[model samples]
Target: MIPTSKPHNPNFSSGPCSKRPGYELTQLDISTLGRSHRSDIGKSALQQAIEQTKSLLKIPADYKVGIVPASDTGAMEMMLWSLLGKKPVDVCYWESFGKGWFSDIKNQLQLSDVNPLTADYGQLPDLTLTNPDHDIVFTWNGTTSGVKVANADWISEQRSGLTICDATSAVFAMPMDWEKLDVTTFSWQKVLGGEGAHGMIILSPAAVERLESYTPPWPLPKIFRLTQNSKLIEGIFTGATINTPSMLCVADYLDALNWITEIGGVDAAIARSENNLAILTNFVNQHEWINFLAERVEQRSNTSVCLRLSLTDKQLKEFGQLLADQQVAYDINSYKDAPSGLRIWCGATVEAANVELLLPWLSWAYESVKNSD
Candidate 1:
């Protein structure tokens, strides 16, 4: 039987996710559209975005939050280029994005002292093996694999090295241990459901000190340079970006930020995402054919929830298409580098009711694909 109901918004893509419910382009303030980003109006809007982000996430008073270029990928690259060679590094990876970072450290940067710690798609590397004295690079959430670090308990509080995190999928929807993180990067397009091409980097005081004291042996691109003559560039954090940004995107982000605030800030947003996952959790628990990709319960991500269905690879593809054909779900297929499965965006912007509606359709799609074969 076909599911009579469907998700109100079938935009389950892991990136550039669904916008907040009741989101209207007309509601966004377009006052800064024609203004130059260098203008006082433009800079003020950018700076407000930074300040609101810091406040919502409860980032430290001493930490610096800046808007950067090229979304999360670019921010991660910039941090890697500017910081890695100064110290012996430990790069831990579980999925594609993490693997990309590890490759950058060992292959691209060609850093000789790199220590690579890895795990298959559904598992996490042994974070306990990380040396406190060596710089650490890893993702807080494995978006492709549906796994996430349970907590910052594995990180050493007394460590001499920096903890650089790619927290793109976990920031607003998850409770973060900011003190344990030295450098963190995310984008506007994740849990916030804003437009893309912009990234945010949050730097702890220790990270700033490192920037001021050390320089990478390699040449730094103008976009990646965080300091000049061993002095940290203060303007970037205060809204003077390294490159031009889309004002329309900025307005959209501001609208989303305001939505988060109105709905009880980050706590409420986290609860919404958790509830969305809970809806899927109940369905998975009752059905023997579907299971979460994450092996550990605690390590499962509430944002990018990946699942394995009892279907062949071809069947999996057909199952996803079936859902899309009925407008039940969209972009729910697993990442290309990940196993054959479904990856649902259970982020803050996604509604629990929509998730509930999506569950019955999953069973219907599975059976439809199964019977055809």
Candidate 2:
């Protein structure tokens, strides 16, 4: 059994991601209880969250933002189902989530005219080979593999194809060039530390045009549908969700967004994640038993920093369990499809001091497990 107490430190785990600074579950707006979400009070709070998200991310005034039914998975599928098949798609895969998209393209959509550009877990597909005329799907950050695209510089500024990004883990933690991204999706459970069950989708002017002009061959469920009566439902982007939402979750997200704005918005959030990553990098550099799963420093994720143990698979598993026994964290393991390792979430809410304190304990756990073996 894992120990119950430590120095009030936390070890990073991927998702449901980190909580806001000084977060307390009991501190939520409990008065939201016994209130209908469709009421004016709830709607007002939800609207504020939507507006705050737009302001904090520096999203352009022309873009539309909406809260969808599912988490990142649902929001992404909604975009794929609604927007894809209008053009030849060039899908990029470098991690498990990307692979999932490939599966959706082949198995679900059954599209035969798609181009898949894939790479090993730690590397990226060659963006140079991507055809600017074909729609491209890529993740801004590979959460499971701890690899990320550094920038949108490779995308052609004059290209016609849509650049859809699954930015679930990257949003708020990184600076996104909104002009370069045609469709962007994220979840409240990620950087904001809000409860799960909702996803946010942002559409560029180009994406809006596609939704209005082109209809997909597949039939869309009412929930997934974005176009209504031959026009895009522009109201949905302004806090009018397709169905009911948890008012409590919306309140939590608003709290998080308020906290984000207070700390200087997205830039400060990125800096906080980068600083947390520096703590881990410094620890990794001095430890022979651990190294970054990302092959290059440039490819490394400032939010999800994956690391592999310099030991056999069995040894790695043992050490992982030992760390758990010490109550350092739960679910530090890598995605099963990737190499054995630990993926640490270093988002804005993760205290830098907590990470610093946890590092020595990780070292101790590794040493203890090795000696026992």
Candidate 3:
């Protein structure tokens, strides 16, 4: 029988994910909204975001975290413009976002001695291909394909080059090996379920050293510049942003962080997502028509859960629309670039009960679409 109970919250978008459980707009204190970001009132809000982020992630004591303009893309570009081209480079990519970094080095920077290590959408590349002495770039999680690197064991103990990672989708849900990563960038929208348009750039001591010691040949834009006269800008990591920021978004992020505390901390947050994925796992296993995109258990993501349904291209499109119209799920369609199927956000903010409610609806939608066709 079709399930009668429905998920109270149907927001499953990967980027701007669902907010914390029982989230309300009234919880945000927008006292700094109308004030300038550089003013003391605004800096206090910005400072809270930076410090709280460090605490929740358990980032290294020595690392520096800075707020940058745009979202994750802007923070990643800032690292490439400021720190790349100092040495030979190796880029590893399994999905679209990782491929974007490869293009940046090849087409945009036109850097010499660049090597690309790639694999199909569902699998990871050869981590051994990177040279320890050469700068390496990769994404910790393949968001579009719902695959993520299991761990950071491949990195050497004392590598000369930086290990830059686009970890927008992996930060809170996955346990990060902070020592293995030299430069990591993530957006506020992912696991935290906050507003976008602001990005956080995390720098290890090595990344900071690269910024201070080596200067790239390309002229750095004002927005991308992290150093002044060979010294790292200490102010950016300490509440002094390069440009104006929306304090409303900042306040909302603060509220989200506070909710993380109330929800039994980050471990509980990860557990919520794990439980959601587990529910989906059982559902997919029982149904012969649907299977996980990531073949290996280790590579499967707990955040963006991608599935391959047994259906034609035309049928899958109609099926997704049917699910949406039924008010059971929204944006369960796969990414545009990937194979046709379904992708669900199981981030920390998503309620496991909601994900449980979603699976039976999937079965209902599949049958309805097939019979109608």
Which numbered prediction scores highest in lDDT against the true structure? 1
Q: Candidate 2's residue-wise lDDT over 208-321, tens digit each?
A: 999999889989998899998769897687767888888888878888987898898899999999999999999999988899988989889998888988667777788778
lDDT ranking, best first: 1, 3, 2
Candidate 2 error regions (>4 Å): 1-7, 371-373
- In model 3, residue pairs whose N, Cα or C atoms come closer than 3 Å (at least 3 residues apart or on different chains), thus clashing, are none
Instruction: Score candidate 3 by TM-score against the native.
Output: 0.98
- lDDT (10s digit) by residue, model 1, range 343-363: 999999999888988888988
Error of 1 at 283 (Å): 0.4
Candidate 3: residue 216 lDDT (0-100): 90
Error of 2 at 213 (Å): 0.8
Q: How large an RMSD does model 2 have? A: 2.2
Off by over 4 Å in 1: none
Q: Pick by TM-score: which candidate is best?
A: 1
Clashes of each: 0, 0, 0
